[model samples]
Target chain A: MKKLDNTLIIGIGNNTRQDDGLGWCFLDALVKNGFNEEKLLYKYQLMVEDTDLIAKYKTVFFVDANKTALNEGFLIEKLTPSKKVSFSTHAVPPNQILNLCETIYHKKPTAYLIKIEGYEWDFKIELSKKASENLKNAIKAFIKEF
Target chain B: MNPRKIIIEPVTRVEGHGKVTIKLDENGKVSDAYLHIVEFRGFEKFIQGHPYWEAPVLVQRLCGICPVSHHLAAAKAIDQLVGIDPENLSPTATKLRRLLHYGQVFQSHALHFFYLASPDLLFGINAPAEKRNIVAVASENMELAKKGILMRKFGQEIIKALAGKKIHGILAVPGGVHKTFTKEERAYFLDGIKIPNIDTMIDWSKEIIDFMKNYHLENAQWIDNFAAYPSNHLSLVDKETGALELYNGRLRSVDFEGNELLNIEDIEYRYHFKEAVKPWSYLKFPYMTKYGSANGWNRVGPLARLNTCKYITTPLAEIERRIFKSTTQNKPNNMTMHTHWARLIEMLHCAELMKELLLDNELMATTDLVRKGTPRTKGIGIIEAPRGTLIHEYHTDDKGLITKCNLIVSTTHNNEAMNRGVRVVANEILSEKPEITEPMLNQIEIAIRAYDPCLSCATHALGEMPLIVQLKDYQGNLIDEKIR
Candidate 1:
């Protein structure tokens, strides 16, 4: 398989939900902290399921807050698996999107899952302090990898 | 005799989700009528803590129908707060902005006039829901309906050329517009004009006036006693000449008799106007008083503007003033139906204004588009949106990050008026009938819809469940519960 060239940093969450916006928050911090806009590619909300957008990138970094069965402020790291997680309402899952890319373009991009632990997803304005702190830490870690 | 309950659910062919409910009392009297909004997108809350620069783009998303109006108002507000004289923008850029705005006003009004309200006026109220649409009207009056569509397309094209995107163009910024109109763009805009159609539209408007004169005479009676409130009318007046300004002007509020309320300098808005949240809806009602709930039925848009302006500037607008004046009863306030006439007059004004700006030689001068500034200050931007007065107030930190943002959209200003109008129509229709038919209720709904209330822009209440109205007799027995 041909290796991917560009890195896609996908931030996924409903912005209306306060702490659920951690993934976007971390991405925004990265953008603010002198991250080159050219190298960093693709930002999406809720789900990165746009077919056209998914097909172009070689590497996909899915950044989202994991609310179910995860420690608060913990990072869950994983590589793209053959079997994709099933979620209703999404156009296509992450693995399926990658597979489609490979089938069509004769190349598959490396994928990384960076899920931040979130405490509250209630309808509120301000972010929880713990989630906010975890977001800063996640950004720091992501930058180290860069 | 049992009075029938009529429910117009998910009022179609409009911008937002709203419903009209008419309730009949035991005496068969129309006890209550309501034009209620179901869904609420909290734009005010969403915009908080973002950059002040994103105000235009974010606020524009509030309504797909009137994105240009929101864009212009947001840009004007930021320009005021940044203390940049947007009048310094090349006249061509200013004209382009005006042209785009005119397009928004024309298309939006045309949508209301042709698609929404004209169905009831042209066809009887009892017409089938499926047939009561612009398509039905177009089938009978194809050329006339096509004219409106053509006019709307012209406006959209102008917006697309200037703003890059016709709907939510981010061209208007703090100092001035980002894009300039090339000679080719200007020629292309002028190329599509149907010159003969202008005469046709003028004739069609005259026919509309005649129709309203014959049939809507009683409709005009409801607003006969309407009194022009002497409160301040706020608008963006040109800073240089103090003439009626559209795009880049300082916020000025004048009374009905033409008295200045306040200059509303960028920093002084917090002192003049305060935003109050209502428990009934998510939309924040803005009041002129420094403290307390928003009181009194203050108005915005064309009616308030006409009352405030000393005289109409454009020739077509001046001619159209007769249509506004022709319907007046004892005083100026009686002709609420004149809002329709007033809207057309403004459309003419907007078009003429665009032409004037384009012809000016000074418009071609390109100086500074973006002023280099690092000063962070909280400021308010106010402009006369097409529907009414729109205010966008922002509190920003020293880094220009938005701490809090409040938008008093056009529909919010007309909320009280719309409710009052609904009540008046209900009272008039319900008093005479022992049994109300679905058609009668539809007429009442049409009366309220004539205002063209932007429910999306208005305050959002909790989601509307199926309305259940129960009527009880004096004996405490369950009389009836109408479920719709």
Candidate 2:
């Protein structure tokens, strides 16, 4: 296992969609724990598919809630692109994003995904109890990994 | 004589989903023409129960292309509802907002001129499908195309810096923006001002102006009579005092004859304005009932803003206006075909405003992000969105939970105008040609698309929408139909 000095952690989820904000919550926790700004790259939404950034970074951590698969708590797993995830609202998907980085820059960053199980995907601000707990666990695990 | 059918499906390279239909009679004459919007996502309905503070974030999701405009309007609305004074917001915060807006103007106008509308100019309307794109234009005019790309990128970078992300920024809150512009950020912004390639942009704009002068002058007759109606025009005016108020001011209503009706405040909006839903489209039409019979289903946005304002404040835009007026009747409504021209003028104005706001020393003094006051029982925020006039009306409980919310987007104002424009084109083109073809229909669609209606913003959201198109003959028979 390689421990990187500099890391870019991105939280990808809709904050209004309850558990979709899991990625952002993890990012908030890291900031609260006195994580230095230089070691983190916290983002709420993946608006543009800037492939260059992905290729340049050493380690990339993406935190989002998995709505399709129900895991009620934090599920820490290393995610590789299986085809392209069309679940994103953007033009480029996660798989294509990785592929673009590799093909264009000949570099692949070590990537891990932290998915918290979400119960509510509807338009709401407050998170479910299970999702909130999952988020807390995910943050702990993420800190441990760092 | 056998009639040929022309199909230009998916109208590629545009921002949103839309289609064009044209029918010609046997004698190669146009029989019917229409511009049809295929997708409809109701954003208004989704926002009904959301908190007032969250309105900015929710509405920003309306359009990926111009999310900043929605964000600005929503922020303005919140400010209005809460009656937060401009002085309360740090002048720096306001300046940052203005800068972001100018950045929006730069990128959006560039997208329209370079990618969407340029094809019609660079390649003639009759250009082959493969040859009519920015990529094709880049192959020949690489430097020119690169300038547009750079300009757009610069604008996006400004937004990305001020707000955490580009598309939907959380920085813009109810009272004011959450963050302030640091010295480093200001230096980075000033560094952007040093780019020498901006000269290329000026030259490109001049070329576009020349094209508008020549080609658009000839085609102006088509848009002249289409959707010509009288209505009041409303926008944010500085009012001698430099205070910013989008929701509290009097709504300026300008007539077809360029006369001011009454500049009533937001509370009086119901007395003068009422929204009517048409069966043809999901967009709601806001009409001035005070004008006796609602004859004026007027437009909002670029063209409407230009028409409403007495004089543009910016020097560069004023110069452009002089040149624009030299070619026209000097009346704002006369140059309907010059909506593209109006967009560029507003872009200049927004830029000038941004520069002035950034230089204001008072902007750095404000520290209060949210006003320390009770939430209003009821409030309305009205601002001129990039598309046009946007209104966010809300009713909140004592606990700050939202009870009801109503958003009347800019696209809704143009709803009636679009329908009227389409009917005019359809009546003229369809009646002349007997055979219906795709190219002929596309021209009519182009007319409607010139408005750039964001129906998603207008309607709010329910679910993913499938495309739908319906054609009716003179005898009222269903001639052609497609729904997916």
Candidate 3:
């Protein structure tokens, strides 16, 4: 894997929730591909403290499972801070973290979101076959694009 | 004149999914109201087959906001299962656990005030929905928002250092904590070099309390009276001195006017408490069995803690607590909105407690982290979580597998109190009104939010809960629906 300095990759989702594990699985794939383990973070959800974390990095990539269908099994798009705000300590959206970072720390890291389509959200840990395929495509596209 | 019901589904700015239903009589007068928890997670049943040693880690899956509370509570119970009571634990181990618990409470209270409840307080309930959020709070008051973020971070950092991660991190094992605090970890919080130090946290906590006091003074009419009602209050108080105790203590309950109802050993909770289920919601109403279902229910959170404890041990918080009590002439403050004030005082108390622990050299002990004695088949652990009193009880068979598990989470205890609050607000704001407006709906939510109810633990689910309101006729036909 190519070495990327000063870049933080945050994989946000719960691995116990079947396809919701896509984000963490993506991070696992990166580690398997020889990416620096320190650069990757696995999170069940984003929180206010994440703003402090992203401030030190020059770039950040948020990867999570998307419930909605995307044309490509996966999509990677540049991200902008969300003006709309909603909060539940159980989970906070990635874009909102970026917005908080810009608001508090006055630093806007170059950010992008890699959303992999998912299915079968249940209590089980195993991803559905279709979601697994989408995760593979997402990892492949993510590595090439970055 | 047709009777109607107004439903507010998925209250905004709360932890999990809950809905409010206000039933109006044919005369357009409020007849009944309820706060319903929708999702259900059978954690108690799922935890039955797990080993006794795994209880601490397994229970954390119940909540993200207060996982540390769950983790510590389960750890205490696991400690008893291994035959070590709280008093028998090594002093170093005990202080380390206390520090971790205080850190958990500190961060959680900061999150609740700065992120969740601050919006409703900063911008009045009548303010537009878009403006009632942390982002909007940040846009308007950047320094305040930054302080909120840093204050929360300080607490998370403490968790990370003691445990391994911020959420669901492992700290305690069966008999005692798995690890000990180090000088570097202690310095990180005390030295104030990297992040704001303990002193700074204490200072900022004081500043917030002042802000709350001033806010109360300006909005006294609403702050003291909104959704206010008299009921029983419950929490853990210091076993010996009767001072405010969060980590471990004897159970205490007092009525609305400051009458002692029950004060007993924490482990003997089952003998006094009973849970009653309602068909309308997944959450159960917990009350003292003696008082019966209707009158037995008690509110168990910051407001309850202040109401039950004789005095705060910390000097600064004691001062603030006195001022808070004076508002009601030192009687139990039944004001629902004053919960935010009590929560801030607790945050300050936690800050003072953290400083005392960090400065103490006992945290440096590396040995004697675990201890055990004669084993027990059943163990109960209760602690003051940020939201309220959290109880975890487990029974294991000879094979060491859990045979039964019961959890009376903080939100569960306050279920009835929240319903009463909703009814109070609905009656005040919506009774006799022909139309249901957004502000009207928000006022009902404000009542529930005052308790800082963690519906995730109440109903136990993980998902997004968007705000939706539906109006129905008395016969249960949907007349109108609106989603935000």
Candidate 4:
């Protein structure tokens, strides 16, 4: 068992929405692999108050289901603060959250966004076959690096 | 030449998907305008056949922003199905429910003001689209943004503590609540160790109201006149004292001149009100049947509540209410943008009410959490949600299954009012202008945002629904289009 101390991982998406549950599945894989449960946070979407949670940690990872095509099953890229104005509060993008964290609390944590390629997004709990494969690969990649 | 129509789809910064349609006659004069709610979730229709008790939990699928409101409203109705009236509920249960309701109101007001309305107030309507959002507000005024966030967080914490989660948590069950407030849970808000104390919430609430006052002073012309119109006002007031009451009270309505229109028992709303549907929107127009469709529509929410109430029960809020009333010379304030001002005053009121409940010792009572009475087949629950009066009615069968359900949410009550506002703003801003800029389109959104309508509770997929303004002629051909 490895201790990922001083780190926070947020899985953002709804489990009920088929492949959108990829983020939660990734975190679930980490838990099964003996990762600490306290370090992981689950959310349906990002909100303004999330800045407070991310500000306390030294490093943060945001796991979400991606709609766009990807070279690999998953990709992990560093996230920087973005000033992109969101039209609605329905979905606050990860970059804007980072920006809010820096602007509001003045704490800049090292952040990475792990976007898993999701093929299906309908009203079902189980992931699609391809999405499941991507989740597994994403979990393996996440574990290999961390 | 054919008449022209301009559409602004999915207006920004509000909760859900909505659009504004402004029609121009052949002469380029504004003929009509409407704020259409495009997203549809047949929640009331689908809620049928579930166990009557499940209404509270299932109805929470309404909106993430104000699920607690729906949860409680349904619970109040379910209590009737279980044969318990509101008065018969235990003191502890009533207190717990009131606290949760106040928390919902407080957080919702804070969110609306800070995230949605403040951008327009802070940067003015003429500011660039990018500069009129939460990120820009935070960048420019860090302290105000921080306070807004924390004030909202405090109310959410209260909801989380009582309901189990902030968004979809459940506290009330059939006759009463399932749990009581604990001393440990209470201290988290009172001790000022982990989060800002309730007193801090009170102070911040007052500060924001003051900020609104100053903003109003500086921008009185627009703040006072923009989309301003005379309309009826509706809310729930204390049955006995006629003071501002959110949790449980008589349904009160007043005309624009402060004349009492209707004050009825909450359960008798069906007799007085009717919902009329429009061809353009899924949202229904709710109005007093007596006043007919045209004039019966009453504006609900902070401004309406202030107008209909005799006074506020809380000391601090009563004082602020007096000042708010004085601005309009004790008349029903018809200034639409003053909704922000009224909403801030309500944030202060909710904070004060939460503090009063947090200190009361009865809140810790573990006994009498649930109550049961003579069972009934029909129940109606009405509460003043942060936005306005919310009604939930249920009809049950022998097996206690919901046979039918109807909801007249706050936003539905304000549908006609919002359409009127859009017409007002569009006529003023876009009637004769040859070129419509993004900021000009924003003025229409500014009017609708004042009501803070929760347009849809639909799914928020990982994409932005950009504001699309399309100019189309009477033949339905796109003449011009703009996107932001």
lDDT: the better of candidates 1 and 4: 4
> Taking chain A of candidate 3, what TM-score results?
0.95
RMSD (CA, Å), candidate 2 to true, equals 7.0
lDDT by residue for model 4 (B1-484), tens = 5699999987887888888889998877889998878777788888899999999998987888989989999999999998999999999999999999999999999999998899999999999987888888899999999998899999999999999988899899999999898999999999999889999999998898889889888988989999999999999999999999998999999999999999999899999999888788888888899999988999999999999999998898899999999999999999999998999989999999999999999999988899999899999999999889999999999999889999989988999989999999999998878777899999999999999988764221122468898999998999988887
- Candidate order by decreasing TM-score: 4, 3, 2, 1
Which residue runs does candidate 4 get wrong by more than 4 Å?
A1-4, A69-72, A120-122, A128-133, B457-464
Provide the overall lDDT of each model, using Cα atoms, as 2-decimal numbers.
0.59, 0.61, 0.91, 0.90
- Residue range A6-97, candidate 3, lDDT tens digits: 99999999888999999999999999989998899999888877888898899999999999999988999999988666676756788888
- My TM-score estimates for the predictions, one after another, are 0.66, 0.71, 0.94, 0.96
Using DockQ as the measure, the top candidate is: 3
Candidate 2, residues A25-129: lDDT per residue as tens digits? 777777787775555555555532344566658777777778766554767676564333222223444554555455445568777777778788678877788
Prediction RMSDs, each to the true structure: 12.0, 7.0, 2.4, 2.0
Identify the candidate with maximal TM-score: 4
Q: Candidate 4, residue B360: CA error in Å?
A: 2.1
Docking class of 4: medium
lDDT by residue for model 1 over B1-484, one digit each (tens)?
4444445565544456666655655566767666666677777787878888889888887775677888887776676557654455445556656767766776676656655666666676678654565555655665545555455555556677778855667778776777666766665654444232333334444454455445456554433433222343455555554555555555565544455665555335567666655454444556667324434335566666665454566676766565565554212332345555566666666666656654554444565545534344755666666777667777788777787877777777665555556667677776657555556556555655655667676653223323244444434455555553
Model 1's chain B yields a TM-score of 0.81
Candidate 1 has which clashing residue pairs, if any? A13-A46, B77-B381, B91-B363, B92-B363, B301-B388
TM-score of the A-chain for all models: 0.76, 0.79, 0.95, 0.95
- lDDT by residue (B2-75, candidate 3, tens digit) is 89888887787788888888899998899999999988989999999889999999898888878899998999
**Best by the lDDT measure:** 3
Better of 3 and 4 by TM-score: 4
lDDT of 3 at B132: 84
lDDT of 4 at B444: 96
Q: Which ten residues in a row have the lowest lDDT in candidate 4 chain A?
A: A83-92
